[model samples]
Target: MEDDGRGFSFTVGSSELVDVGRDSGVWDVFVQAEENAPLARIGRLLDDVADRKEIFVYPSITLGATDVRPYYTVDNDLSLEVARQN
Candidate 1:
């Protein structure tokens, strides 16, 4: 899981469903999110490098745990379905 600078489990986007965090190099992306920014800082410090990809818009976030849900909404509506366990 990626931290949104506050050490909280940061989700890259608005999709609520939990995504498999296998060795897909995703963590690398998060760690190197902004190469131009310092590796450590307060309030969403980000440094951009030539190869860094812009992901999160905000930097600082309240430190918290992200409780995994059993399901996610299929659409912007209230409809829901159970998430399959690995």
Candidate 2:
């Protein structure tokens, strides 16, 4: 993860990362899985945007007109993770 004077940018493998600007007050991520098993949650992505606290939620991925992928959020406490790597 890297913050380039704007927002955060995560390097998901070797692909070029998309920068999420802090001024936009939005953080978007893609939840991918090959199987039907559910994706695990670790924590909430919260940021103070324009003096207002907000929890960042995952929105739908829009790459093209016919390439929109919807995603869902799962709630989980990081405190409950015993020696688990996030």
Candidate 3:
């Protein structure tokens, strides 16, 4: 993810799950939000990298869920999925 403070950019590469075609590479993107963010954020981000569009960005999100772990004390698990942008 690349950001210029006022705006940000994401680059998608090949050899990813979203690869739409060969010669796939980084695309372009735009984002805007008010008090609420759009759900397309996930798709856009995932698709961008996988489909060779661009990096997708959504407003920061806060999720809430019950803790079911018995011995695990970790509160959150963050994971990143990498796919081809093409």
Name the top TM-score candidate: 2
**Weakest 10 consecutive residues, lDDT, candidate 2?**
77-86
Query: If ranked by lDDT, best first, what sequence of candidates would result?
Result: 2, 1, 3
Q: Of the candidates shown, which would achieve the greatest lDDT relative to the real structure?
A: 2
lDDT of 1 by residue, 1-86 (tens): 77567554444452333344431111112233466965532122245432222332223222122223221122211112223343
Greater-TM-score candidate between 2 and 3: 2
List, residue by residue over 1-86, the lDDT tens digit for candidate 2: 77577444354431121222211222234443437867644344464333212233334343222122222234322211011111
Predicted candidate 3 versus true structure: per-residue lDDT over 3-78, tens digit per residue? 6575555564322423434332232222345457652222222222343222222232211211111111121112
Model 1: residues with Cα > 4 Å off, grouped in runs: 1-12, 15-17, 22-35, 41-86
* Two-way lDDT contest, 1 vs 2, winner: 2
What local distance difference test score does each model get? 0.29, 0.31, 0.29
- How many clashes in candidate 2? 0
Ranking 2 against 3 by lDDT, winner: 2
Better of 1 and 3 by TM-score: 3
**Quick one: ranking by TM-score, best first?**
2, 3, 1
TM-score of every model versus the real structure: 0.16, 0.19, 0.18
Name model 2 segments beyond 4 Å from true: 1-9, 13-42, 45-61, 65-86
